[model samples]
Target: MTPEPRSGRPRSSSREVLSEAACELFLEQGYDATSVSDITRRAGVSRSSFFNYFAAKSDVLWSGFDEQVNAAARRLRGGEAVDAALTGIGDGLAPDALALAITNADAMGIAGELDRDRAVRQFRLQRELAARFVRDGMPQLAAEVRAGALAAAVLAAVWAWADRTAAERVLRDLLATTIALA
Candidate 1:
């Protein structure tokens, strides 16, 4: 017998299960050594199911940012623009799920690449956010750019700090600097 085909809607639970399994393997065996087949076997799902959920393993880390960013944008949409943007970013980063992603060695293995992806994402998000702020009568592109810059900078700072200090301290400093810059 064959399995039924998936429709276009996102399958959150399966994706979440695959992501959790991937993180566990990544933490245990390291990222480079883990394969899609290994992840599929561990998750007790077929290869097709995994592909239906994520384009690639790295995508799991990328998935939640947009939703969180949108949520942040909504929260800050009508408020003091820079303050609102930072608040959104800070809130986005504070979730425990993010901690799990970062702590995994396989996830960390993708860090350099992910950082680049993040910077690009930040730039795109900033451009959209700047437009939103402007439409709401905010006049400062520089401030908005600064807020976005600080957001990306905070992540880089946290990566560096994580090497020498605790994750909490790194996060605290990142939040402080991001907020201060905005």
Candidate 2:
């Protein structure tokens, strides 16, 4: 077990451990076959501890990205330019976690199962981003279009990163380019 940080909360290492353990189990036993108990047992953590960090098994794969998205949304709401906001979001990508999931997607049986959930989350993110842009003085339709494009770009970049074809490309750069085109 990791020691608690100064704030008396377990260090972020606990989350990492859970995520790593979940991914390994997903890859080995298949995502459908792995339960929260299995992940907790592998991580040597309590069930409550797992709940403290993740709402569901799939969350182990997306929580980091979701955190980044929320941060970017906050920046957007703070009047940051769309490009800069998207760049911030890209900058938040957890390379190691994402790479692990992408590389083991097939083995984990997550490739097809993720689309619907991902699409829903992406749409919600797009709406929130668009709303922020509108509050920042952009026209509604324009904000919506820009948000949609930026959201799509983020998805594309994740896919590219996972595919390992963008080995030399930085996520922020991809986001910047996509925003520029938008």
Candidate 3:
């Protein structure tokens, strides 16, 4: 017999299972209509297990990217050059997950919300990238400008690729082109 959600410790894979279940439900019934209860039921986990993995429903889409960003930030702090740090960021981009989220954005009833979140995330990332560049010896003003343009390009590339099949290649090519242009 399976243990109840709160009755026993969750498996190590609980977070992935919960995220997958939430994405499935979000694609089916729409994000606005799917509750945490519905997700837990689908995953056969307790409601508390949902909270253990994510702070909120929207986090299902962003958590992987957040982890990547955090990791890139740590690398930057280790004194990596701006170009190298951005390459690390590109390496961590989960194109498949991002494409899935974008495809379901309208169905999930989070088109606007996702856009807002993306903008905010990009703004913060750009600022941090610029700071890191300055720390690596670029002038502050040049660093800021370069980071802004690079961030915009990266976001545009990702958004454009989200609708395309074989998005991983597109993302890679776009990032390579952007870095070359920079």
Q: Rate the local accuracy (lDDT) of all candidates.
A: 0.62, 0.79, 0.74
Cα miss at 46, model 2 (Å)?
0.5
Best by TM-score: 2
User: Sorted on lDDT, highest at the top, how do the candidates line up?
Assistant: 2, 3, 1
Alpha-carbon deviation at 159 in model 3, angstroms: 2.4
> How large is the C-alpha RMSD of every model relative to the true structure?
5.8, 3.7, 3.9
Which one wins by TM-score: 1 or 2?
A: 2
Candidate 2 wrongly placed segments (more than 4 Å): 1-9, 137-139, 165-167
Q: Which ten residues in a row have the lowest lDDT in candidate 1?
A: 90-99
- Which 10-residue window of candidate 2 scores lowest in summed lDDT? 4-13
lDDT of 3 by residue, 37-145 (tens): 9988888889988888788777777776677777767877887765666656557566544567787788877788689878977887788888887887889999999
lDDT string, candidate 2, 32-143, tens digits: 9999999999998889989999888888888888888889888877878767777887675757555677777788888776776578677977998889878878899999
Off by over 4 Å in 3: 1-11, 92-96, 137-139, 166-170
Error of 3 at 127 (Å): 2.2
Order the candidates by TM-score, highest first — what do you get?
Answer: 2, 3, 1
Backbone clashes (count) for model 1: 0
Supply the global lDDT for candidate 3.
0.74
